[model samples]
Target: MDERKYNMAEEVKVFSTWSSPFALRVIWALKLKGVEFDTIHEDLSSKSPLLLQYNPIHKMVPVLVHNGKVICESLVILEYIDETWKQSPLLPEDPHQKANARFWAKFGDDKVSSIWSDVLMKEGKEQEEGVSASMENLKYLEEEIRGKKFFGGETIGLADIALGWLAYHLVIFEETLGLKLIDQEKFPSLAAWEQEFANAPIIRENWPDRDKLANLFGVLREANLGKGTPK
Candidate 1:
């Protein structure tokens, strides 16, 4: 591990929502860095003043408040945590390897929203187009994972952490959207990656219950589809 940027702080505080994939990213990063922090669960429906104050721009959850300084954006917070507490280390030691990891991390961050929007937004021609684009992105990722157990190599690292949200949360999106985007036969690498991602002790233990998340997704889909009173 490289020298830490921030030391001497006894504890850190994180503001987040349990069901959010963005929040899960922060949780995974902190856990990987072996950082002990207090978690403040926020209600998205009723945003707290502190949450708004911490993230004035987006007012979103998954804000990291470390030593009284607030940091918004999940990916940015992950990098901050990595730089501040370099114990286990999220990024690689080599500069080139770190660049490679950051590249995939950026790709996942940039394209995942479109994938979710396409999967959860519409049907017919629009959905078909979305699925096609989503598959293309997934294909690139599958090739990236061709020979490695995880994105960072033999172990999970920044790229895996960035992409981790999709591993568990995507099932809800797929079921709700009725899209077969990641068929096991078609994308066996990512299929296997998802199982490994979900099985990580920190990930498995920290995630929102699958049934609960599925119910939430069902509600969102029904609301979007204008039927069933959002189940």
Candidate 2:
């Protein structure tokens, strides 16, 4: 009566969008577990029937369809993947340590989302305020990961997966906005962590194309803030 065992005949499919950090979390988690899964690239503007059927409430990408069962939300999917596969453990063994990892993961999601909605989408004073808030969030994380190579420890783990966007996508934000959000002087530790995270073999291989992300963010910034016209 092993909960982790699944029939080999069952299909493992992930409905995801290429540019979504949320979907990337699922991809990273599955890859870390060495779980082979088929990916279905989804168009968020006009989502597919399968995505809608699998995730009726949110109908978002990163919907993991295991056999016929569906799991939504990136963090939830990460935990499920970890539990299902015992290799390359994502969460710590100790209960207290596990809770700490979960806490940081949740914090990373909140801060990243805030930067998107408040900083990237706003202008002038409001954007300035958002930047300040984002800095504070990064500072807290910088202090947390000062001694450790990664959030969970020496190896990539749940918190690292949660904060993966900061390592790659944050550059797109800085480039598109023409502002320095996480600089060496301000967030030295977090800046270093970004490099380390991006350079990891698995992450380096799977990271989204930089030029494409830059173009996408540039278009999004123009649409939201009416900044430089998107090329």
Candidate 3:
């Protein structure tokens, strides 16, 4: 919390927010690698001067400041973490495998907008179409993850950390809106991965408070739908 403390001992510090899955990615990676870092919580509503200085362009959370060098973007931070800490690699050694991990991570991010615009913020035929599109995208993942417990075999890897947002976000979105984004029976592998991901010790510990997120998104959904923020 104190600026002076940052310069005192630890070389790693993360600018973060409580509910952001992006921020959590950084936290998970650091913990997985057994890196010690201090987290400075940011209030997005009132942008901090320190955060702005560290990440001048995006001015966002999950900014990794190591030895006075700043790294912006969550995905970039994950890569940085992997490279800096040799223990518990988030990516594989094989080039082809690494490429595959990057691909799936991008695939997951590209789908996020659709969830917000097409599914979460729509209704009637539009919402139905959104759900269908999501399921179709998920089907690809279903097949890919069929035999493995995680995206990169048994251990959590780049793709897992990158797309980890979905584990909690989709569940909260589904519960708050009463819309089924995923049918566990239809997407058994993906469903299993989601459950396994959320329950994993590191993930479970770093997760945003479930009830808090549920309430926040529930109100957000209502506000977005012209439901006037349920009293």
Evaluated with TM-score, which candidate comes out highest?
Answer: 2
Q: Please, what are the lDDT tens digits per residue for candidate 2 over residues 82-114?
A: 997888999999999999999999998876569
Best first by lDDT, ranked: 2, 3, 1
Question: Which has the better TM-score: candidate 2, or candidate 3?
Answer: 2
Worst 10 residues of 2 by lDDT: 1-10
* Residues 1-231, model 1: lDDT tens digits: 222334324558889887888888898888777677889999898999999888889989789988888889888888898888767788899999999999999999898568766767667788788888888899999999987788988788888988987787887667766667777999899888888888989878888888898888877766776775743
- Candidate number achieving the greatest lDDT relative to the actual structure: 2
For candidate 3, the C-alpha RMSD (Å) to the true structure equals 4.1
RMSD to native for every prediction?
Answer: 2.9, 2.9, 4.1
TM-scores, all candidates, are 0.91, 0.92, 0.91
| Candidate rank order under TM-score | 2, 1, 3
User: Which is the better candidate, 1 or 2, if ranked by TM-score?
Assistant: 2
List the candidate 3 regions with Cα displacement exceeding 4 Å.
1-9, 229-231
Model 2 earns a TM-score of 0.92
lDDT values, one for every candidate:
0.82, 0.87, 0.84
Report the poorest 10 consecutive residues by lDDT, candidate 3.
1-10
